[model samples]
Target: MPETLPAPCAPEDARRVACIGAGVIGGGWAAHFLARGYDVTAWDPAPDAEEKLRRLVAAAWPALEQIGLAEGAAPNRLTVAGTLAEAVADADFVQESAPEKLELKRSLLAELTAATRPGVVIASSTSGYPMTDMQTAAGDAARLVVGHPFNPPYLIPLVEVVGGERTDRAAVTWASRFYEVAGKSVLTMDRELPGFIANRLQEALWREALHMVANGEASVADIDASITEGPGLRWAFMGPCLTFALAGGEGGMAHMLDHFGPSLKSPWTRLEAPELDRALRDAMVEGCAEAAGDRSYADLVAARDQGVIDVLRATGRLGGTTR
Candidate 1:
């Protein structure tokens, strides 16, 4: 491994950012950096990657504009690089959003680390792969970290950042600070957690929902409504743990847990995932199509972006505050 490297610049002072692998997540990251007034260079191997990336950025620019752009933000600031090396040659930070295959990730990170400046931080957008596993192939694992972002990275504020065993503590701290400097809400994790925090919680609920569907208990639409009409409202602002604490009616989390702890043993949730057989697969697809009604994919995306923007504003997050 190369000698431990220092960051080229403070996160706030970073100027050029590289987005490797120009798919949805990669494109979203590019849109985000561009909206924040950073010089963005992106690369992908797909024949039409540049066209698709530009379209995705163009489509997302409106939502970003609604949220408010940095002083010099503009779509014209983006550059599509022809190769991986060219993309990160001068980047102060590199964000890799390649496909989720393990071997592919390992090789890509290794190549990315080799091509990028030794001190530049390289973050993977893998949803669940631990940084420890992904950093194995990197020449300088000290600078590698996992920077998991939600879909439409331009609008979503929460980014989960963590480092592997070989990752430097300073790298983790730098990545977290950089994400904040770029206008993101950061969750700096001490240890690697498979699926990270949010995804693990979501998977649990997702498993139970699938189980209910498999058992003929609840329709997919019902499951969606159960969230949208119920706990989802509270979750938009208050997280589950604190929201449940409110259930104690003044006694708070301690009393609430004491009273409901016994029910934990009840067979209410099926943590194990149900088999995704042909029938279940078809059902899920059909259910979503039905729920989507006549809305096109673009229409749905627009609605989701606007909805998130409204939520952020209502919560006062757009102004970097809360009511």
Candidate 2:
């Protein structure tokens, strides 16, 4: 048997969490941990990272307040560590949101593994790479798992949790429970799947969008509308499966699948991805800019945050959230 390190405290019982990397995702995670009333220690190598991270948490605080902050939640609880070792030395749970580079992740996790006390659960905010590939370099791979979150993770409820081949089932369970206690909706996966569940579906949708834009088959505005004005509304309360299940009227998924399964042979969707050549990339960027119109990026972010909060309230997921 591989040597097991001493186990850390249960996630629900954890008081301090470590966030490795302080870019958008990492900073969002820091905001989340702070909102959940945990003392968060964050480490980042970039210049001005401490300043940037604090600003991010500050920006996210209003939205978090709307979502209802935990009793003791406060931004003053965050600490920026000068070194990776210093950040995670006493963390009960460690969340790594480092850059997606394979080698960086490999070395970072290994470093974290060495520095963190035994039994502490470590999770990566990796969007796609399977944990198996990333765990080889870790000193204790059994305690590492992926805890993928969507953009603007401070308010987004979905968190996909999965373990690598070498990861202990207990760790996976621990991370899932931890995310739940932290007010996230957890999708605990059974096995490793590329992009996991949500991203795989999202990537497929995105690929088709790129194909359309590249071929002049659709404008960015058209594509955005096709979802926002159409399926996106239903998607707030129900997924594509459940939404389509209603398409069969009195029939359920079985009937709906039987009715539309034949359409699977249609060439409507371009499965092959469009290359991100300069021209295509420019077109995508310009199209988005046009779609943004008068709204700046900050304006868009605030609008989106409020929109999500409204959606959560409407869906009864916010537990009586008012505005």
Candidate 3:
């Protein structure tokens, strides 16, 4: 690896950002950086990648505009690069949203790390893979960190940042602060945990949901309503831990845990994932189709984007300062 370059200006002052692999996550990152008034160049290999990315960004624009764009924010500020090297050659920061395949990630990240100017931060949008694994092939693993974002990245503001074994502490700090500057709620994790935090919890719940479906215990719509009409409303503002704390009546987590700890052994949970057999797969697909009703995938995405914007606004997060 080449010697590390001196650290540059704070990420907030960064003028250019590169988004590699212009899929959903990459395109979302491009949309986000553009909305923040940064010049963004994106690269992906698909013949239709550029067109798809533009459409995705165009779809996300109204929600971002509703939240208030930066002074110079414009879609025209985005550029589609013909190659990965071209994309990150001059980028002050690079956000990679490539495919989840580990080998692909390892090779792509190494290439990205080599191409970008030294000391520039490179963040991956991996949901579950620890940075330790992804950074293995990077030239300067010290500058690589995971910057996981939620779906519909333009509307959702939460970003989970963590560094791998070889990552420099300064790189972790830099990425965390940079996400905040980019208008995201930063979860600067101290250590890398499997699936990070949110995905672990979500997967646990998701597994149980699949189990219920396999056992004919619940429909997809039932699962959705059980949350939307039940705990989902509270969860929008207060997380599950705090909500359970409130569940202890006058007491808090200690009391609630004391009362509910014994129930942990209850047979209600099926932690092991149900085999996704043809029947189960068809059921899930049909359930989603039924749930989507007359709406197309694009329609559902649009609805979700606007709904998330409304939730952020209601919760006092939309357009709020992240510094």
Candidate 4:
């Protein structure tokens, strides 16, 4: 914390955002910010990063238009800065989407903190790394936080916000409020959890899926079908916990847990991830290729975007802060 750190502006009033890194997650973030009517400045070291980022934002514009944009929101609001320092020079908020290497995160965050305005919050789009580990290199760790989002952040509504050991409690609160203001569903965690909330659940399911695939217990398409055709539908409107609560009929969660708790001892799932050996890797690759059939990457992305839009509409989550 700097002695001269200014009082931060209200999260909802924030207008200009700096996105440091132009990869998929970073670019998706840029698209989301643009859709929310913020002027976004992005910086990436890759030679063609600007071109790719612009293309990504262009591809996502149609879905954004359907979801509804904020006043004056347009894809043209994006600016590809030539350097990271230039990007954050006037940023009201900074979002770092660098690669997942710890050292890279440490150095990049330190640089960002040094470059960004003193009171502006700086967030990382890390999938799992705790802010405590990533904030060590920052000159002022108080304003650094984790703002983890799922892929295609422009569509996903959930963002898990958490602060590290050195992070100021107020900063955590600020980040959470900012995410909600930016039209995202926020899970403001009190303490760091391994993989956060959603990813932890996703990892368990992913591990089980891999184990099944490795053991030839289920085909790739079958596993996908099990979710997309079954629980996934309910999950669109109700979470797994509530969905299970319904299983108890009038008994609610207590009865449901009591009845199902005993069955927890069954060897139903392999929690540990199967080794990504050559055979397993090849199987996963080949299986996905076969499942994809004729759909190109662009086609799949478009299909997914439309599907998410439909689900959001059907569930009545498109209005308000959901989109």
Query: Judged by lDDT, which candidate is best?
Result: 1
Over 176-253, each residue of candidate 3 has an lDDT whose tens digit, in order, gives 988888889999999999899898989999998998999999999999989876677666755665456446544444
lDDT for each residue of candidate 2 in 58-126, tens digit (9 for 90 to 100): 999999999899999999999999999999988999999999999989888888888888778899999
lDDT of 3 at 13: 78
- Runs of candidate 4 with Cα error greater than 4 angstroms are 1-7, 272-323
Q: After superposition, how far is residue 87 of candidate 4 from its true place, in Å?
A: 0.4
| TM-score-best of 1 and 4 | 1
lDDT (Cα) of model 3: 0.83
Inter-residue clash pairs, candidate 2? 6-119, 7-119, 8-119
TM of each candidate vs. truth: 0.84, 0.83, 0.83, 0.83
- Give the lDDT of residue 3 in candidate 2: 37
On a 0 to 100 scale, what is the lDDT of residue 55 in model 1? 99
Clashing pairs in 3: none
TM-score of 2: 0.83
In the predicted model 1, the residue pairs found to clash are: none
lDDT for predicted candidate 2 compared with the true structure = 0.85
How much lDDT does each candidate structure score? 0.86, 0.85, 0.83, 0.84
Candidate 4 — what's its lDDT?
0.84
Model 1 regions more than 4 Å off: 272-323
Give the Cα-based TM-score of candidate 4 against the true structure: 0.83
